[model samples]
Target: MGGFHRFYPNACDLRSLPVQEVDESVSVQEGQRLLQSGLLGGILLRVDDVYQVILSSDLAGEEGNQPLKTKAWRPALFIHARMPVAELLEQWMKTPDAVPVVADEHGVPQGVIDPLTSAGVLHHEFTRIRSYLDSILAQVNECICGIDDRHKVVIWNSKAEELYGYKAEEVLSKRIENFFSNLRITNCMHENKELKGHYHQPTEGTHVLISAAPVTHGSAVIGGISVEKDITEVVQLNQELTRASSQVKLLEQEIKKMSGQECAFRHLTGRSAVMQELIRFGKKVSTTDATVLLRGESGTGKELFARAIHQNSNRYMHPFIVVNCGAIPNNLFESELFGYEGGAFTGADRKGKPGMFELANEGTLFLDEVGEMPVEMQVKLLRVLQEGSFYRVGGSEPVQVNVRVLAATHRDLEAMISRRQFREDLYYRLNVVSLEIAPLRERREDIPELVHLFVQEFCQKYGKSITKIEPAVMTSFLDYSWPGNVRELKNAVERLVVLTEGETITEQSLPENLRRNTYISLVTTPAAQGNLMNVAVEAEKQLILKTLQQVKGNRSEAARVLGIPRSTLYYKLRQLGIPAKG
Candidate 1:
């Protein structure tokens, strides 16, 4: 036991030299010493007058070994120690709701690393971290919170409570949907897979930011961890930062998504017009023998669309194979895509296994990032298309494929053709039926619907309810440009869902990046003149109106503040559609 640590054995011992008694509970410190001792057989101590001791399986298994009693999780007692080990074991025995701990090689019992301690050290650490976070949040002056696995409100920070008119205690055990009013919070979470900088909640006029990570145990997911912050005011001050982050990244990840080659279109999420259109097109082209091409931005669900196309085609009943032509190393492209016969290569498969084409006969074959295919492979593919045949290395038999082809890529084939990097002839062949997917920003109207689907999905996934969004949130969602496209939007929506403390989402639930500042475009040309003037007047009018409202409709005071006559102030207010407060 001492081998794992630096502790050395004492020169002299008080009790019996080596071996002794049976089952009994001993004091904790004393039992530790006995286990630390070099020589010992069995020890015992009476715990609450009940004698019990744990026996080593090694000794018990021996033909003439001693038999001893044992408990599953609790430490065993050795009867040979000077003091009864039973007394030590009894100290922690029958303790209600104790967490299990594994013993190290040296018999050191411990659980997670400093996570559950309530000692001052842990308390201080948590406090320091919280304080630093709070300071940063305060500098931005935002409201933030997060949720647990069941979607319960685990982190209703002071600011959140202050803005929502609820105490942390009142909101702690409840799920976010229980108190929220907007439905968009769930939607935003679904889009981004993370809540960006600041977001709004279901509570009107309040905004927040939320982030989360999942916690897993074995094959099951125990729960998740999340963080939140409110930055409505701060974002308004610096609207240039409206781009928020994704929730998937914010939350702790138990499993990695790996890469596209490792996944058959995993990480894809969509159910909008863009998604439906691709499916409809796939169905149309898949039934026929025509080759299909899927074009979209990177991470815009192209591979997923390709896989779906193959699955629904006439080849659905057969082996639907996928090949990432771009991912195959240039040197190994031929061997990997076109398998070798026995002795074809230095270390070819002795059985002469067929290439992807042979395996995909009478089925659907998907080519991802086909633009990345080497020119040599392009000619080979052209041969297969022109004549339903290809030769396996060292084999004379030409393999015929009744296979349908579906190819997808993020690159512009026309641009690649201009560069002469991709084969124009092959592009024309594959482009018999092309499906172009619109980016997320192009179809902003579909966002609301898409967000809802994700929220509902995540609710069932995390065993949580769908929280809502604030009214002001959509203004930002619509205003911000999603460069990462629908995929990024989906991630944000998921983040918002986990961060919420209520059912309704609000502007407060929208991420900071979603509510970024409006850039002042300088357009001096006559065509853009009207646009710039209108924007300016609108801003000035709103500024005056907001200032007037702040003073509670004091027209005289507003006029004085604006350095204008009361009549002029009233006229301008009427023109801007700003109503007077009673």
Candidate 2:
């Protein structure tokens, strides 16, 4: 016991006692007697020079009989007295029920650490550390899966159980590949590589994004850890957004259709049979990809019809480009139509520029006054129409384009073809569908409606109001031949609205060529002076003739304009010896 005190001075000093030893041959009865006398809480049993701990509880008997040998005593944990006191205390704290035997360098028992007293401080610190770690792991939202080097699952967090539908007890220590074949953890361990944003579909309708990393110690990969985020809701939301976008596009198309029907064709208005038929045909051609040739006078609204057709087509979302063939210079026609390369000419742009055809790709191209294109350029235009490809100026490569061509011309293409002024091949190509707008003179019945429409339009533009037109002014409009067609009529009405001061437009406010008396006399020949009755009768005859002509020989319209009954007009026509029908 003195040698034991020399070996572990501090442990002996703390208890203020010397070491106690028991022989291996001592019976459990003797050991209980020592404990009852309060001489020892535990004792060391010597085996040669080594020592083992024997707790006082080991002396208990099953039925009042003691064990014969120490072989029946449970194994004891030993510590060297030369070790630090703090380490010795920690060992006792981990196993509070087991006694620790402190031995010397020669393995002789030096002291014993009473489990009840040494474990109190260490137990409190160990419990606090364990609680902190468990709380942190429990609060994690991402599923955590960890695997050892042997490919067995070691850590399965609560989030993992919720996400993968498996409990920790069921999967721990099991082979990970048996449950999930393509887990990133297995791949990361085998490849020793970090994977990020890896997508995996474990089951139907279950999508997860996984980020995994190799667990390494001292530059050696020993295990793998992976974090999984459930992305099923995100995937579902993206699919729904795609479907909603498609529905919105369809609704926009329907709205454009209704708008086209209501106002896109407002420029092509008339009640004449020929004009009605032209409008119906134009509407039909608007839905097709066919080339359209609009033939009419300059102011006949051919360009307006072209725009309406484009607005009603499927390519309405793309650009609608207009190129005036007659307006572009003959020298720059080819370059303007087909684009140019960098430094193609002395004054060309350094970066080059896309021409009308390229600009109008996937869209409509309106070539107004197409008959004005030179004969040489007509061949190039025909090639683009036939092949859907063309070469830029000074460029070796041919550019491809998808474009719909809509051509308008006031010139007589057939007559020009005869004189070789226009290419017959190009003419045949352009005239896939032809529409001819009737001159305004030929549709005289539409004049009043056009005048009213123009009045409303110009009034809004100039911020003025003129709602009424005198009967004499309207009669002059019906009788005059509008050589410039609807455009000319529009200009005349706009002038009246802007320049007239009165709320009503009268004959005094009319232009020189559109006066009532002048138009009536122009349609009838002058007669010599005569008696009052004769002069009055002559004037009435001239007025009736002019009104009949103005209404395109419609007797009902004629009587309406003249403010006479149809029956009275018929009787007067018979008395004047004039035919009622033209």
**Backbone clashes under 3 angstroms, per model:** 104, 0
Clashing pairs in model 2, backbone N/Cα/C closer than 3 A: none
For residues 175-212, write the lDDT of model 2, one tens digit per residue: 89878875778788789899898898877888999899
Q: Once model 2 is optimally superposed onto the true structure by TM-score, how far is the C-alpha of residue 375 displaced, in angstroms?
A: 0.6
Worst 10 residues of 1 by lDDT: 7-16
Candidate 2 runs further than 4 Å off = 1-252, 257-263, 520-582
User: lDDT per model, in order?
Assistant: 0.58, 0.78
Residue 578's lDDT within candidate 1 is 76
Q: Quote model 1's TM-score.
A: 0.43
In candidate 2, what residue range of length 10 has the lowest lDDT sum? 1-10
What lDDT does model 1 reach?
Answer: 0.58
**RMSD to native for every prediction?**
26.8, 19.8
